[model samples]
Target: MIEIKNLSKAYKKRKVLHHIDATISNPGIYAVLGPNGSGKTTLMKICMGLVLPDEGDVYIYRESVRASIQYRRMVSYLPQIARFPDNLKVKELLQLTEHLRGKAQRKEMLMELLDLDPYMDQLFRNLSGGTQQKVNLVTCLMYDVPLYLLDEPTAALDPVTQIRLKEFIQHERERGKMVVLTTHVPHLVQAIADEIFFLLYGDIYFHGSVEQLIGAYQANDVEEAIARLLMYEQEKVKI
Candidate 1:
């Protein structure tokens, strides 16, 4: 479970997020949709305790994330971009991560699922962009955290890999894990999202079930519905 209350963040004097409140509980996939610079990544960072909120609180599993930083151990965060030590080999990286995680079975399972074996001997910097993304995904999934926060997880993934990743997400959700993802692609969101959050100007302008979004926008698909909502927000701003 994750609880965010009156959460806000800023750099210098410019505020990216305002007072916001949201709660996500149990095993379900939550999709967060927002325009560029709407603070979607910022929110995820705060939830993961990587960034402190300028105001308000974040509760993970009923405890303040700030008070129990170890709670982060139970979370797997896939940031917008992942950076790895240029010289480390895939196998070495996984080995180090597993050592740090105290040798968890989940790490091995994720490596197998991502087909990372082929690249085991290759240096991190030598891998292709898509392969690097695959490695990052595998790393995060390895923790077997009950909560996952993924940002633009499919950016460099191929179609088949993307489908496989989605299937894995679904499997985790079925196992009663919480997954929160931020993506520009609405089709993927439609396929896996049970709940959707539409963000504008650092605020959640709308949050509801997927069915409600479809009905409210009267759209044939999730992508169209999100487009309509974005346009509606733009029009409101203009007025």
Candidate 2:
């Protein structure tokens, strides 16, 4: 469904992504894992056409991102930070998003699931961080699109809401939609990700299933596996 070919990006002297190549051909949750500055967000932004690649191209359903923007209509994106107008009410933000995008088929359902009705009349800036994140989620997930790009989706979410979001993501996968998310939470990745793309310093360090990741690192769990990978790199640097 998506193809990233020899994708590279740099900002002045520092490179954020390097000749990255990956393909998503099936419908499932794919986790893009990495430490800070590992180019996780950069990759997603490039895919969304929000940022242009320094080299190479991304294709969605065979259409190059550099070619046209019509392919974005097939994607639903949740940015890491919620930056809506401060004065707008929750309801207004939803209305505005729907106005910009087409009508959201699952807006009402997601609002109920996220318990957003109580906050509908509240100003976006007045809402709590978690509430704002919930609102962000509703705006993104309400669209019934073929692909979802979520960046740090559970950042400020409560445990209950996180569980609900995971369930919703699973449901989307069950319905044959591709969900790509970048998260630092190991357990969340273990629970929902069918495939993992582990990024380290602008390169894909590992790409496999959760089981394969742990097994490759000879670790019992995701957390330990990640630690081991970092330790391995550290040891390499000292060599």
Candidate 3:
């Protein structure tokens, strides 16, 4: 459903993504794994048309992101950080989002699932970090979109909320929605990702299923596999 061709991006002298090419043709949960500054967020932003690629193009359902804004209608993005007007109440913010987008198909359900109903009348600035993240999730997931781009979705979430979010993501996949997320959590990827794209030094270092990643590194689990991959890359740099 999505194709990225020869995509490259640089910030002044620092290159974030280097001629990257990848495609997602099926409906499932895909995880983008990478260390900090490895361009995971940049890649997703490019796909969402929030950032322009210097060298190539991203096409959603056959329409180039560079060619049109309409392609974004199919995408719902949850940014790594959530920011809103401090004075607005939680419910008011949700209402504003609904006003901008169309009516959310599952807002109330998400709010309930995230335990956000109690804080509905509270001001945005008054919510705790975890609660704020829950609000962010409710806004993003409430829309019934074909594609979801979630960046560090479980940032401030507690274990219970994190598990709920995972369940929601899995449910989305079951409904034939394509869910793409970037996370440093190994267990989260192991639990929900049908496929993974591992980014290192601005390129796709590995792309495969969770079992394939562990098998490729000869590791017992996802955490060890990732550690091995990082150590191997560091040794290569030293060589």
Candidate 4:
């Protein structure tokens, strides 16, 4: 469903992604993992056409995203940080999104699933961080798209909400949709990810299944292996 070719991006003197080449053509959840500044968010933004790549091209459904953006119709993205107009109420914002998308989305269903109906009339800024995140999730997941790119979907979510998000992701995969996400939550990744891309220093350094990752790093679990990989990358940079 998606292909990235020779993708590279930099800001002034710093590079955020280097020749990132990957494909997400099949249905499954792929997790992108790394320490701070690994370019996970930048990678997703480039795919979404929100950020222009300094080099290379991203193709969605065989159409080049850099040249045309019609392919974005197949994607649903949940950004790491959501910024909404403070004056608008939660329900109003959702209505606006549905109007703009011109689709009969499952907004009401998502609101109920997230338990956001209670805050429907509250202004965006009035919601607490976790509540606001839930609102964002409702809007983002309301539509059924072929590809989903979620950056830290579990962030600011309560434990129960986190589990709900995981179940939702799994549901999408079962429906034959592609799900790509970046997260620091190890247990979440362990539960849902069919594949893992360990990004380090702006590049994908490791790609494998969860069990393969633990075996490769000789760590007792997913979190420990992730820690080991990050440390290995940092040390490699210094040498």
Count of steric clashes across candidates, in order: 0, 0, 0, 1
Alpha-carbon error at 83 in model 3, in Å? 1.8
- Model 3, residue pairs in steric clash: none
Q: Identify the leading candidate in terms of lDDT.
A: 2
lDDT of 1 by residue, 162-203 (tens): 999999999999998999999998899889999998888878
Inter-residue clash pairs, candidate 4: 1-25
TM-score of 3: 0.98
Clashing pairs in 2: none
Each candidate's lDDT (Cα)? 0.87, 0.94, 0.93, 0.89
Which 10 consecutive residues of model 3 have the lowest summed lDDT? 77-86
Instruction: Pick out the ten consecutive residues of candidate 1 with the lowest summed lDDT.
Output: 101-110
Q: What are the candidates' C-alpha RMSDs? A: 1.4, 0.7, 0.8, 1.1
How large an RMSD does model 4 have?
Answer: 1.1
Number of the candidate with higher TM-score, 1 or 4: 4
lDDT of 4 by residue, 188-225 (tens): 88899999998877788898999999999999989999
Compared with the true structure, the alpha-carbon lDDT of candidate 3 equals: 0.93
Kindly report which residue stretches of model 1 are placed more than 4 angstroms away from their true locations once superposed.
Answer: none
